[model samples]
Target chain A: MDSFVLPSFISPNSEDIKRRIYARIRSDLHRIEAEIDRNINSSIPLISVVARHIMGSGGKRLRPLLMILSSRLCGYTGDRDVSLSVVFEFIHAASLLHDDVVDHAEFRRNQPAANTIWGNPGVVLVGDFLYSKSFLMTVGYNNIRILEVLSSATTKMAEGEVLQMVHSDNLEVDEEEYLEVITRKTAVLISAACQVGAIFGGASPEEEEALRAYGHHLGIAFQLVDDTLDYTGDVKELGKPVGNDIREGKATLPLIYTIKKAKPSVKKRLGEIFCAEEILPENFLEVREMVMRSGGIEYTLHSAIEHVQKAKESLDIFPAHPTKETLVEIADYVLCRRV
Target chain B: MDSFVLPSFISPNSEDIKRRIYARIRSDLHRIEAEIDRNINSSIPLISVVARHIMGSGGKRLRPLLMILSSRLCGYTGDRDVSLSVVFEFIHAASLLHDDVVDHAEFRRNQPAANTIWGNPGVVLVGDFLYSKSFLMTVGYNNIRILEVLSSATTKMAEGEVLQMVHSDNLEVDEEEYLEVITRKTAVLISAACQVGAIFGGASPEEEEALRAYGHHLGIAFQLVDDTLDYTGDVKELGKPVGNDIREGKATLPLIYTIKKAKPSVKKRLGEIFCAEEILPENFLEVREMVMRSGGIEYTLHSAIEHVQKAKESLDIFPAHPTKETLVEIADYVLCRRV
Candidate 1:
C-alpha cells in the first residue's frame, strides 16, 4: 500500500474543487443510489426495514463514488458500471452494520444504530444478508475477478477488525501496528473498489495497478484525517461525540503520536485515562488538551497530506481527462471533508 | 418438505442402523474432517483460534456429511467431493458462530461459546471471515451454480433467523409459520448441500431433483426431532441444557402444538409461564408436563417420521446401490437417533 510518508501542499481552494467533482459525477451518484435502493429490498419485511434504515442513513458513498469515477476514468462504456457500483455500497453498508454491533455503537450518522433499534441478532443477520446480496449481484456478471477481489477484501477486512479488537485499550500499540490495522480494515476495500472498476473498464494491468495504488494511498489518507478529526472536529459536523475514540479506548494515529511525544508525567496520565475502566469527562478533556499541546493533530494532518500527495502522483500515468481530474479532486477532497 | 402428519412404527434398533450408515461413509467423513482443518487456518492468529474452537466443538457435520454421501450416491469418483464438502462445513460453522452471539448462548457442546471468550466483536468478525472464505473457495473451481446455491441459501438463512425473531414468544405462530421458519433456516442449506453435490457429480436433472427433495425432507425431519427433543430429551444426551428453546422464548413446533391442544386452564398456565418475565424451575417443569399431557412431543415426532418417510421415498427414482441404501438408513436414523 506504499506505507512510507512524504509531504505535499494542501489545496487552499478545496471547496471549489469538491463542488466541481460533485457536479461532474452528480448524475452517476444518483443512479448508484437508485441501484442501492432496488437491491436492498427483500421478501422478508424486517430485512428490508433494517437494511433500509442503515442504507438511508447518510453515508457519503465515497467508496461507490470512487468506483464509478474510476470506471469512467478508464473509459468504461458498458452499462454495468452502476450495477457494479452497487456492489461497493452493499459491501460498505454491510460492514458498517457489523461494525456498529461490534463497537456497541449507540449512534451512527446522527441516528441510533440498527442494533439499538432492532436488537443485535437482527442487525447482525441483516449484515449477513447484505453481504450475500452483494455476492449474489456479483454472480450475475459472470466475472470471476470481481468475486476474487471482493472475497479477499472481506477476509482481510474481518481480520483487520479482529486485530483491532486484540489491540483495543492497549497503551503500548505502536504506529506501525496502527497503520497495518487501517490499511487492512480501511484501505483494502477502497483499493478493491477502484481496481474492480478498472478491471470492468478493461484497463491494462499497468493502469489497474496504478488505480489500485491511488486508492490505497487515498484510503489511508482519508482514515488519517478521520482520526485527526476525532480530537479536533465539532460534534455536530462529525455526527457523533467529539471524544468518541477516547471513550472507546481506540489508539488512532493522533493518539499514538500524542503518547509518543508527551512528557513522562503526561504520558502516564494519558495512559491511565485511556486504559481506565471508564474514562471520565474530566480525564477525556485532559487527554484532548494533551494531544493538542503535543501537536498530534497537526502531525497527523501532515501525514495525511503526504499520502494524498502520493495518491495524486499515482494517477499521473493516466491521460488528462475530465474523469481523471475528478479522481484527483476527490483525493484532495478526502483531506478537507468534515464528515 | 412433506408437512402433513402420518403414523409410522418406530425403529426398535437405531444403533444398528446408525452403525451401518457410518460404516459406509466413515472414510469419506475422515477426509472431510481433514479438509475442514486445513481450510480453517488463517493469517491472523485469532481467526484460527476462534474458528478451531467452534469447528472442534461437537457438531456432527450433518450438512457436509449429506453433501459427501449424496455425491457418492451419484457415483462421484473425483477428489472435488472433499473440497465441496468443506464449503458446507464452513457455512454451517459460520452460522453457528453468529447464532451463539445472537442467542447470548453461554454454552455450546458443553463448552463456553466463542463470544464468551473473545467477546462479540471478535466472534462476529470471525464468522464473517469464515463466510467470505467459503465464497473464496468456491471461486477456485469457477463453478457458477455452486455459488448461486450457496448465496441463495445464506440469504434465506438470514431471513429465517429474522423471521424467528419476529415470531419469538408469540402464541399465535401456527404450524405453517413454524414450518416456514425451519424450512428457510434449516432445510435450505441442507438441500443446497445435496444439490451442489449432485451438480458436482454430473447427475441428470431428474436425479438432482430427487436428491434435492431427499435433502429437503430430511432436513425438516431433523429439525422437527430437534424441536421435540427440546421438550422431552435428556440434558446429557442432548449435549446442552433441555428446554433451552422455551427459555429462549422460541415457539418451536412442539410448543405450537401444545398451545393448540391444551385445556383452557392449562393453556392459560402455559401462556403465563411462557410469557412470564421470569420462568422459575417449577414453572418450567409444569410446562414440560403439560406439553407431555397434550401429546405435543408425540405429535411432533409423528410429523417428523412422516417427513422421514417422504425423504426415503424421494430416493425411489435412483437405482439401488450400497450408497443409496446408506442414504435410506440415514433418513431412518433421523427418526430414532437421540441427538
Candidate 2:
C-alpha cells in the first residue's frame, strides 16, 4: 500500500512522455502482442472467441505499456526489446486467465470472464496455450538469464496462486501473506519487464536493479489500489461490482481491518457470509457499511497511497528523464484514478 | 492399432529387442524421473508433493524406452536423445494430470488420480510445473529445433485436450476425428521423441522422416490397442475398469467401429451410453459383447495392426543394427503389453 498512492502525492511535470522513444515503444509493444497472437493455439475456437472478447474490450494494456516505456526510459533501441515486451503482456494475460479460474470469476473489467462463458476447461486450456507461447517466445532471444528470470517469475506466479487458494475462505489471512501473493502473482512480471528492458537496453547492473525495484513497487501499488477500489470506489467507474473481494471470500485489506475491529457477533456474522461462494446484496451491503463504520476502507486506501509513494521513491535512483517522469505519472494514476 | 501391435507380433525377433532395451530404458527412465523429482517446482514442498504423487505411483516407463531404442536404431547414440526420452515421459505425465481433471478420473494405475487426491487446482498447477521444467530442460540443450519440436508438440497436446472436451459425450465422433485427437494429444509426443532423437542423433532427412513415421504410426497403433484393451483387458492387469472409455462417453476404436455396424436400436443404445460419465460393470460387459458381435472391436484391432506394420516397414531404412533390433522388439512388446 505504501507504493500505491505515493506517486500521485509526489507529483510529476510530464503529461505523457511524448518522445520518439515513447512512440517507438508503443509500436514495439504492438508488434510483440501481434507475434504472440500468432503463436497462441489456433485450434481452440474458444480461445479465439475469448481472446477477441477480451482484447477487443479495450483494455488499458498497462503491462505492455510498462515494459515498453521502461525499456525506452533505459534507452533500449532494438526491435528485439519489442518482442520481449509482448512476452511480458502474454505473461500478464496468462496470469489473469488463471486468476479468474481461481477466483471463479464471472466478470472482468465490466465484461464476462472467458471461463464464465466458455467453462473452466476452455479457460484453463487457453491459459496453457498462452503459457506455452510465452515459453516458446523466450526461445527466440537465446538469452539464458532472461529465460531464467521469466520462467522463475511464472513459477512464482503459480505458487502465489496456490498460496492464495490455501487462504481462500480463511478470514484470518494477514496483510503479510496477501502482500506476498500479489508480489509473486503480480509484481514479478512488472519487475521483470523493467529488468529485461534494462538488460536489453544495455543498462548496468545497478540501473537494472533500480528499474526492477521500481516496476515491482509499481505492480504492488497497482494491485493494492485495485483491492482498495473493489471496496470503496464506484462500481460504474471501476467497471465491476463494489465490494467484490468479500464475495470471493478473499480477505482483502478492508475486510481484514473490519474483522479486526468488529464486535464478536458482527465478526461471526461476517465470517459466515464471506465464507460462502455466493453473497446476497443485502448481506453485502451490511458488510460494506460495517467496514466503512469500522474505518477499514479508509485505512486500506491510505495503505494503497503509501504503496504508490514507495513506487515513486524507487525511481529516485533513475536520472530525471521523460521516461522516468512518465513512470512516475503511471504510479500516480494507479493510486489516484477513480476507476 | 496396426502400427502399435504388429511391430510386437510380427517382428522376426521382437522379443530380443524388448529384452535388451527394457532394463536399460527402465534405468534411464528412473534417472530422468529422478530429475523431475529433483527439479519440478522451485517451491520445494510442492516439488516434494509432486515427487510423492508421481514417483510414488508404480508404473512402467515405456515411452522413454521407445525414444532411446528408436534413436539407437537410427544409427546414433547420444546422451541428449535419452535425456529427451525422459522429457517425453514427463510430458506424458504432465498431460495425464490435466487429462484427469478433464476426465474427472478417479483411479489411475491402481492409485488415486492426482486431481481426486490433491484436488483439481493442485493437479493443474503441478502439471504446469512439469511443463515449465520440461521447457527449461529443452532450452538447456540450446537446440532450437528440438525446442520447437517439443513446444509444437506440447501445443498440439493441449489442443487435442480441448478438441476432446468439445467432442465429449458425443457418440457421433468419427474415426477420422478420433484419430486426429489422439494423434495430436497422445501420438504427437511419442512421434516427437523419436523425431527429436533422430535429429539429435544426426540422422539424415530421409532417415529422420522414416523414424518419424515409425513414431507416428507406432503411437497411433499403441493408442488403438490400448483402447481395445480398455474393453477387453482384465481389471487386475489394467488397473482401471475395463470399458472405461465407453463409460466416459469416449467413442474409442471398438465402440466407434461397432456403432457403425449396430442395428438402429443398438446404435441408439450406444448414443445413450456414450452420454455417461460412468457406466456400471453390467453395462460395460453388455457393450463389449455387443461391440464384438457387431465386429466393431475386430475391425479396430485390424486397423491397429495395419499401423504397426507400417511402423515396422518404416524401420527398413535403418538396416539391422542392434538398436534396430531392439526397436523391433519394442514394436512387438507394445502389441502384447496388458498394463
Candidate 3:
C-alpha cells in the first residue's frame, strides 16, 4: 500500500519500524529457505533458484513487516510469529508468482517475473509448494483460530480471483464491486496478518477486533491508492508496468470511480475502449487524463484517506506503546505517500 | 502400478479383509461429505453443487477405508484416523477434478466429469477450494509430523503431475521412471495416511516406517491395477472410457511393458502411433490385444501380487490383532478383489 509511505515527518518512525522488522525477516527468510530444502524432497537447486530469485528480487516486504510489527504492537513475545510472518510472506510471494503465470505478466517489481524465468509449470507447482509449506509451518500452532483466519483469507483470495475473472473487461463494474474484489484479493491477508498477531499474542477479543478492523481499513487504503497509482503511476518508481491492471481488463477503483462521476456519453466511450480487443498505449494516457479531469482520481484518493483515518482511529483503543504509534504512523503514511 | 493386482486367488482370508474394510468405509463416507462442506466457504450453493455431485457419484472410498484399516492394524484407537483418512480422499478427489480440467478429460469413474458439468473455471476453482480446505483440515491437527507428512505428499503429488506432463507420449519411459511418477502421484498420500496413523498412535518409528511401506506398496499396486483396468476394466466397475488413457498417448505400464517385449517392428509401429495426433480406434484395440498376447497384463497382475505380498509382510512386524489381520487381509484384497 503506497498510501502507507509518509514523507519527512513519519520517515524516521517508519524507518525504525522497518529496521526492527528487517532484521527478523532476513533470518526468517533464510530459515524458510532452509526448511524448504530440508523438508521438500524435490531437487534442491530448482526450489532454491526460484526462491532466491524472488526473495532476492527485493520486495517492499510490506506484508511480512506489517505482520511482525502488528505482533509487536500487540505485545507478542512468542517465537512463532517470526515463522508465521514468514509464512505470510511466502504465501504472498507464491500467489504473486502464480498470478504472473495466470495473467501472463512479464514483470514484477520491475524485475523479470519468476514465471518468465521459471516457466508456467514450475511457477504453478512452486507456488503450490509454498502454499503447502506455509500450511506446514502454521500447523505448528494447532490453533484453530490461527488456521481458520489464514485459511479463510486464502479461500477469499481465490474467490476474489474468480470474481476478477468474471468481472474483468465488463466495464460497467462499479466501485462497490471493485472494492469487494480487492478487499478479498488484496486486503484480507493484510487484515489477517494483524489479526493473527493479536491472536498469537493472546489479545482480548475486543483488542483483536480492533486490530482486525485497523488492518482491514489500512489495507483498503493501500489498495485504493494502488488502483489510483496504476492510472497515474511511474512504472520505474512503482516497479510494475504502468497501466498493467487495465491491460488485464480489471476495472479497478480509480477507473470505476471516474466512470461513476462521468457523463453517460463519456462513460460509454471509456467503457468501450476498456472492453475493446486491443488497446493502444495512448488509450492508457487518454483514460488517465479523463479520470483526472473528471476528479475521479481525487475522489478515490479521498476515499483512501478516509480509510487511513479509520485505520488510525481504531488504534486509539489500544493503550499507548511504541509499536502502536508506529502502527498509527504507518496508516498515516499510506494515504499521503506518492508512489 | 497395475503390476500389483490380484492373481486367481483361492484364499478366503483375503476375501474377508475386503468385506470388513468395505463395511467400515461405507459408514465413514457419510462424514466425508460433511467435513468437505464444513471447510468450503464459497457461495454456499456453489460448494453444495460441487460437493453434492462429487460424493453422490458413488466413489469406492477405497483409499480412505484402506487408511483407516491400516491405522487400526498399527493399534490406533482414536477416531481421528477416520477424519485424517477423509482428508486423504478429499485431496484425491480434488486432484481428479483439477486434472480433468488440465487434461481436458470428459469422464471420470464412469460418470460425466465434474468439469463437464460445471465448466473448467468452475471446476478448477472448486478444486483449488477443496485443496486449500484439505490443507486447513490437516493444519487443524496441530501435529507437526502429520502436517509435514501430508504437506510433503501434496508437494510430491504436484511434482508427479509435472513429471507426467513431460512424460506424456513417451513410450521409452522405463519402468523405474514410470514407478517414480506414480509413487508421487498416487502412492505417497496413501503411504502418508498409514504412516501418519502410526505416528498418531505413538507407534515406534520403525512401526510407522513399516506401515508406510505397506501403504506405499498397496497404493502402487492399486494404481497399477487402475492402469490395467484402463484397457481391460469393466466400464460398469471402473467408470469412464477404459481406452481413454491409451488414446491420449499415456505411456502407462501395460503399454510400456508390451512395447519392451514386442517384436522390434511392433515396437516401431507402436512408436509411430503414439506420436501421431490420432490413432485409429482399431489400432488402439490392436495395441490392447498385443499387450494381452505379450503377457503385459499378466505380468502387471503378478507385480501387483508381489506388492500386495510385500504390503502384507510390512504388517508381520506387528503383534497379532484383529486390526492387524484386517490390514494383512487388505493387502491381500489389493491383490485380489474386484468390483
Candidate 4:
C-alpha cells in the first residue's frame, strides 16, 4: 500500500476516481481508522459503544485524508501526522453525533442513528467526550497555533449549527445566508484541518494560507455536492434518502435558487409543500421537477465545480508532487462522487 | 469591596458565612458576571437570547469564584484572571444546558429550563456553542497547561455523565461507583478551575497540587450536600422540586446508603416505588422518611463534613491570608448551603 501508484491521468467516472484515490491513500486511511479507534477508548463502555457505532460505519475519512495530504505536500516526514489527522475525524464525528440528535434523525450512513440505539443522553455525552478528547489530543502536540485554529473552527461550527437551526423551515433563506451557514458549519473545520497540517509540516505562511483556502473551497464544494445529492442521487448510492434536506425543511442552495427563479404560482405551491404537516413523496417529486426545470441543480453543481477549480488553483504555490496531484484529484473526486 | 474585611472567626450559621464570603468576593463576582455576559454575545439573535435565558437566571457562580480565589491565594495580580475565570463559568453553563436536555428537566433555578422554552435543538446547539467558546477563550491565553487541564476535565466530565446514565435506575449501584461518578462529574472541573488558577498565579508545584486537592475535596462535599438537599430541601429554597434525583431514577448517596441499611420489607417497597412509572408525592415522602430513619441523611452529611475538613486541611500550606480565609469560609458554606 505504501508503494501504491496514482493514475497518470484524471478519470471522468466517479467510481474509478474514488478507487484510484483510495488505493493511493489506503495506508494513510488505515492508520487514521486505527487511530480513531484507539482515541475513543473510554473507561465507560457506553461511550466507546456509541462512538464506534457512528465512526466505524464506513465514513469516507475525507477530512483526515485532507490533513495528511496537506502535511505531506508541505514536506512533513514525521510520524505524528497520522495521529494528528485523527483529530479532524474526531471533531467531525462528534459534530455528526450531535447533529443526528438535534435533527431527530432516524438513520445515518444506512444504520440507525447512535442516538436511536443508545438513547440521546449517552449519545450526547459520548459526543462531548469525543469533542474534549480531540482538544486533549491537540494539546499533546503542544502547538498553540494549531490549538487556536482548531478551537476557532469549533466555535464557528457551533455558531453555524445554530444559524442553520434558526433558518430551518423558513422559506426566506437567501443564497448568502445559506453560504454563511455552510461556511461556518462545514468549511471552517476542513480549513482548520489543512491549516493545522500545514503548521505541522513546517509550511511557510503563504503555503499554509494556500492550504487553508484550498480546504475552504473544497469543503464548500463538498457540501454543495452533498446538498445537490439530496435532490439527484439514489438513496443506496448516498447511504441516505434523497430529498432529506427538504424533508427536514433545510433550505439548501438548490432550493434557494429554485425559489428565486420560480414563478409566483410555483413558489406558492413550494411554500405549501414546505408548510405541510408532512412533506409527501409526491410533493418531493413535484419540487424536484420544478427545481430541475428552474436549473437549480445545474446552478448548484456549476457553483461546486467553480469552487473545486478554486480549490485546485490554490495549490499553485506548491511545486508539483505526487501528494499535490493526489489532493487535486481528491478535489475533483469531491465534485464527481455520488455520495 | 476591596477594603472589606473577613470575619475574625468561623460562623456556624450558613447565611452568615455566605454573607462574609460574598462580601469578600463581591467585586470578583461582579467582574465574572460581566465577562460571562460579554462572552455570550452572538450575531445570531436566537443564540444570544437562549444563552442569556439560562445564564441570566440566578447562578451561584461557584466555579468561577473558586478559580478567582485560588488565583488570588497564589498571589495572582493580573487583569486577565477576570476573563480567564469566565472560562470555568462557560463550561459549567454548557454542561448544565446539555444536562437539562438529557434529564428532560422542566425547571432549572426555579425557572423553565432553556430546553423547555427554546426546544432541545436550539438549547443543544447553544450548549455546543458555549462549550466551543469556552475552549476558544482558553486558547487565547496561549497556556498549553491550562488548555490541557480544561480539556481533560471536560473529557472526564463527559465520561462521568455517561457513567451516571448507565447506572441510572439501577438498584445495585454502590458507594464506590457513586463516588467515581461524582468525582468525575463535579470534582474534576472544580479541581481544574483551581489548578488553572494556580498555573496562572505562578504557584509552586506543591501549591498548585494543594489547590487542586482542595478543589477536589470541596467539589465532593459540594455534591454531597446537593444530593442531601434533594431529599430535605424546600422547593422554594432549592429552586427545583425535591426528590428530583430519585424521580429521575438517580441513585444518589442518600438513596444508596438507605438501600444498604433498609430492612428487607422496606427495601422491597423502595424497589417497587422506584420501578413505578410515576412516583407520586406520597411515594417520595415515604422514601424521604425512610432515608432519614435509616440515618442516610446524617451519614451523607457526615461524609460531606469529613470532606470539608479535608478540603480545609489542604489549604494549610498557604499562609493565613484574607483570600485563604475566604476560601475556607466558602468550603464551610458548601457544607451548609441549602441550594
Candidate 5:
C-alpha cells in the first residue's frame, strides 16, 4: 500500500558494501551449498539426477542467504543456522521446478529447465520430493513454531500461485492485486525465512516482526525487479528472451503499468496484441518498446527501489551490527542486480 | 521379501462383517466427511473448485477410514479422531490429484479427473495447496511426531512415484522392485495414517507398532486388490477401463506374475506388447486373457488374501472390542473389495 519513497537513511556505496559482505559470508554460503547437495540425494537414481540438474544450475541463493544473515543480525551463534538455511532453498528449488513445469519454461539460471530434460511428471514429483524433504528436515529441529512458519509460508505460496492463475492475462489487474500475487508467490517465503531465522536465533516477538518486515519488503523488491527484468534484462543473464512474460500472457507489473498509462491508441494496439492467438517475436519487441515509451520500466524500477529503501528502514529497529550492515547491502543488491 | 502364502485365519464373510462395521461407524464416518469438506474450503474460489471436484468424487475414503478405525481400536474416544481423520484424506486426495497428472489419467472414481477438467497446471498447484494445507493442519496438533510421520510418508510417496516412473514400461521390473514401488507410493501413507492415529490416541509403543504393521499389510493387500481389479472388476464399478494398467505399461502384481509364469512364447509376446510404442486395444485384451490364463489374477488375489490375513493377525495383540472388530473387518474388506 505504501508508495515508493526513498528515506534519508541509506548509503550510496551499496556495491562496495555488497562486495565486503560477500567476502564475509563466503564460507557459510559454501557450507549451505554443500548441505543442499547432500539433502537432495535419494535412493532413486532418477530423483537424484533430476534434483541435481536444477540444483547444480546455480541461481543466486538469495532466500537462504536472508535466513543466514537474519540469524546473524539477531546475534545468534549456532551451527543449526547452516542446515536451517537449506530449508528455504529446498522450498525455493521445489517451487522453481514446479513453476518451470507450469510455465513450460525452457531455461532457468542460464541452463535448460529441469522439466525440459526430465519431462513434466518427473520434474513435478521431484519438486514434491524436495518439498517433503524440507519438511522432514525441519522435524529434526523439534520446534513447532519453525514448522508452523515454514508450512504457512508454503500454503500461502501455493495460494499465491493459484491467485496468479486466477488473475493470469487479465488486463484489468491493478497494482494492488499484482502486489498481492507477488507477496504470496514470492514474498511469503522470504518473510518466513527471516522470521524462522529470528525464531531459531531466539529473538523477541518484536525483533522477529522487524526482521520479517525486512524480508517481506526485500522479497517484494526482488520480485518487482524480476518482473521488470522480463522486459529489460539481457537474454544471457536472464537465460531466456525478454518479453517472455508477455508471450505467456502474464500481466506483470511493467505491462500492467503500461496498459494503464499508455495513450488510447497504444492501449488499443496492446489489447489487439494480447487478444491475438500467437504473440510473434516482432510483436513482443514492439510491446517492449511501447512499454518503455510509456515509462513502465522506469516506474517499476522506481517501485522496486522504494521497496529496497523500506526494507532497509525496517532494520533500523535493530542495533547497529556487522550482520545488519550486510542485510542493508543485500537490500541494495536486489535493486542493483541485472538478473 | 515374504512369499504370498494364504493363512487359515481370515473369515469368509468379509462383506457381511464390513456391512455391520459400516453400520456402527456411520456417524463417525459422516463427521469425518464433514471435517474433510470443511478443511478443503479455501479463499481462492478456483482452488476450492478444483479441490472439491476431486474430494467430492467417490473413491473409497480408505486411508482416512484406516486412521479413524485405528484410533478407535486403540480406545481413542475424542473429537480429535474425527478431525485427524481428515488429514490422511487430504494427503490421499492430494496424491491422487498429482497422480492423475502424472499418469495423465482421464477419469477417477467414475468422474473426469480433476486434471482433465482444470488442466494440469491448476490441478498440480491445487494438489500442492492440499499438501501444504494438510501440513498446516498438522501443526495445529502441536505434535512433532505427527509431523515426522506425515513428512516421511510424503517423502516416500514422492520417491515411490519416481521409482514407478523409472520402471514404467520396463518388463524387466521384478516383483521385489514392484513391491518396493507400491510400498513407497501407496503403503507408506496408509501406514503413516494408522501410526499418526495411534500417536494422537496415546497408544503404547507396542500398540503403535501393531497398528503400523496392520496398516502396512492392509495397504499392500489394498493395492494388490486394486491391481487385480484393473484386470477383473466391472469398469463401471472400478471407475476405469480394465486394461488401463496395461495401457499405461504399469507392471502391477497381476502382470508381474503373468510375466513370471507364462509360457516362453507368451512371455515373449508380453514383452513385445510392452515394448511397442502404443499398446492396441485388441492386444490389451489378449494380454488380459493371457494373464488370466496364466493364473495371474488368482496369484494376485492369493497375495492380497495373505496380506489381509497378516493384517488381521497383527491385531491379535489388541484386546477384543467393537473397534478392533471393525478394524479386522476392514482388513478382510481390503481383500474382497471389487473396486
Candidate 6:
C-alpha cells in the first residue's frame, strides 16, 4: 500500500482518492505501460533510449488514463483501447522532447532533458519518430474519426507551441492570449485523448461531447495548477526547479493574473525583471512574492477549481460506474497533485 | 521559353526533356502550387512566414511532381490528385525544416535556411505544424492504404535521420549502410509519394507495385546523383556549398567508395581529414580530388544511372502516354540535373 500524500487544502477524506483511482485503474495502467514499451521499440538505439528516458520517467500517465477511462465509460470492452491509449502518451512525450529542444531545457521530470543527453538533432528526429509511430498505430485502427481528432489536435498543439514561443518574454501578453496558448498547446491533446477514446468506444455524439468537455476543462485546470505549482511547489516534489516559468520568461496564468492585479510600482518592477537579459535570483523571488501577494496563486487555483467542477459536471451524463468515478477522482487529483 | 542546360555527358536530344516535361505538367504544377499555398494557410503568422521561406524557395518540387505524374500515368483524372500531391511536398518541406535545424545548415535553395531566419525553436515548431497539417490533410482522403504508406514512410524517414545522425562523423560507414540511410531518409518518402499517387489513381495491384518500384529506384538514383553533385557540381548552381557532405562528415556513396578503394597512404590522410574537428577548405578539396581520381564520382554516377534504368523500366507495363514518357524523361533528367 503506497502512502497517499495530500495537499494541505484538500480534505483528509480525499487522501485515499489517489489510492482508489490507482487501485481501480491499476490493470489499465499496467497495460498502458506495457504497450508504450512495446510500441517505442525501434531499430535505432538512440530513439529507443531517448524515448524511454522521457516516457519511462515518472510521468503521471494522466493523458493515457483519461483515454482509457473515457473509453471504458463509453462501454468500450475491446482490447484495442489499451494499445490505442498509448498514442496519446506518445504524442505527449514527443511534444515534450521537442519542447525540451525548443526551450533548451536542462531538466525534465527530475532528470536531464533528452536533448541534453542525445543532442538536439537526435532528440528532434526521435520526437518525429514517435509522432509517426503514433499515426502508424492509429492507421492500423482504420478509424478515420480517431485520426481526424488526433491529427487536428496535434496541429493545434504545434500552433500553440509556436504561439507560446511568439509570446515568450513579452510582458504584454494578456489573460485571453495566455488562455488561447494553453488551450491549443496543453488542453487540445488531452481533449483529443478523451474524444478519441470515446470515438473508439463507439460513443454517442452527446456522450462524446461530454467526455470532450470533461477533458477540455480538466486539461485547463491541470495546466493552471501546474503554473501555480511552478511558483509555490517544492523543487523536490515538483521534480523540477521552482520558478522555471519565470526563468524561461513564459507568461503563464499566474504571472498574467499577477500582472493584471499588480500596483503601478510592482508592475514596473515586473516589467524590468522580465525584460532584463538575465533575471537575477532576487528578482525571481520578488516576482513570486508579488504574485502571491496579489492573490495570483489563489486566483489561478480558484480558476482551476472552477474548471475541475465543470469537468466533473461534464461527466454527469454517465451513470454510476467505477471508471467514471475514477475519472472524477482524477480530476480532483489534477488540482491536488504536487508534481 | 526557359532555356535548358544539359550536363556535359547528356545527348543534345535530352536537353529538351526538361522543357517537354514541364510543358506537359505545367498546369498540374500550377495546381499543386496553389493547393500547397491553400493548405499551408495558417492562423499563426510565424508558421506562414517560415513555411513560405522554405516552400517558396527554388525547390524542384520533385516529390510532388512524381506524385502528380504517377497519378496521371495511372489514368486518374480527378481533382484530388493536385491537392494530394501537395501532401508530399508538405511532408518533404517539413523534413527539410527539421533537417535544417538538425544539420545546422546555413543555406537551402540559395537562401538562408529557415532556422537561421526564425531561430530553431520556431523552425522546429513550424515543422511540427506542417507535419500535423500534412497528416490532417491526408486524413481527409479517407484512404487507409495511403495513410499506411505515408505514415510508415515518415516513420522510416525519422529512423533514417537518426541512423544518419548515429553514423555522422563516423568514417567506418560502408556502402550498404549508406544505401540504407538514403533509402530511409530520401527514397522512402518519394516511393510513398508515387505509391500514394497510384493508389489515388486506382491502379491495379501490379501497376501500383510497378510505380512504387519506379519511385524507389528514382529516389535512390536522385540521391546518388545528389551525393555526386556534392563533390563535383558548381556551388552556385547547387544553391549550397560544394563539399558540404564531407564538411558535415556525412559519408555518402562517393566518399564511402573512395575510402574503400584508396591506397593505404590516401586512406590515412582521408581518416585524418574526416576525424579532424573542422574540415579545412584545402582538406575538402583534397578529399574531392581523391574521390575523383579514385573514380568515386564515376562509380556513384554509374550506380545512379543503373537505378535510373530500373526506374524507367518499371513503367514499361504502362502504355506510352505523355505522363509515362515524362516520368521516363524525368528519370533521365535526374542523372543529368546539376543541382
Top DockQ hit: 6
lDDT of 6: 0.88
**Native-referenced DockQ of model 6:** 0.90
Off by over 4 Å in 5: A1-18, B1-15
Off by over 4 Å in 4: A1-12, B1-12
lDDT of 1 at B222: 93
lDDT of 3 by residue, A192-282 (tens): 8888888888788888888899989998999988887787766677788678888989887778778878898988889878988888888
What are the RMSD figures for all models against the true structure?
Answer: 3.9, 4.9, 5.3, 5.0, 4.0, 2.9
- The Cα error of candidate 6 at residue B330, in Å, is 0.6
State what share of the real interface contacts each candidate retains: 0.80, 0.26, 0.27, 0.83, 0.77, 0.92
What TM-score does structure 5 among the candidates reach? 0.95
Model 1: per-residue Cα lDDT over B1-339, one tens digit each:
112122346776868888888788789888888988998888789999999999987678888888887888888988888887888888888998999988889888878888999888888999999998889888886888778888888888888888888888888899999999999889999999999888878789988898899999999999998887777666776677777888888988888898898778877878888898877777777888777777888888999989998999999998879888888888888888777
Query: What would the per-residue lDDT of candidate 6 be over residues A41-98, giving only the tens digit for each residue?
Result: 8878888898999899978888988898899899998788888889999999999999
Provide the clashing-pair count of each candidate structure.
0, 29, 17, 0, 0, 0
Every candidate's TM-score, chain A alone: 0.95, 0.86, 0.88, 0.96, 0.94, 0.96
lDDT scores of the candidates, listed in order: 0.85, 0.73, 0.74, 0.89, 0.85, 0.88
DockQ of each model vs. true complex: 0.77, 0.39, 0.30, 0.80, 0.82, 0.90
Question: B202-301 in candidate 4: lDDT tens per residue?
Answer: 9999999999999999999999989988888878877899889989999999999999998899999999999899999989989988988888888888
**2 or 5: which has the higher lDDT?**
5
Query: Which stretches of candidate 1 lie above 4 Å from their native place?
Result: A1-9, B1-8
**Better DockQ candidate (3, 6):** 6
Candidate 2 overall lDDT versus native: 0.73
Q: Which ten residues in a row are the worst by lDDT in model 2 chain A?
A: A1-10
lDDT digits (tens) for residues A216-312 of candidate 2:
8888877877776776677666677876777877787778888888899999999888876579888878887787789776677677778777878
Ranking by DockQ: 6, 5, 4, 1, 2, 3
Of 1 and 3, the candidate ahead on DockQ is: 1
Stronger candidate by DockQ (4 vs 6): 6
TM-score each candidate. 0.95, 0.84, 0.80, 0.96, 0.95, 0.97
Candidate 3 yields a Cα-based lDDT of: 0.74
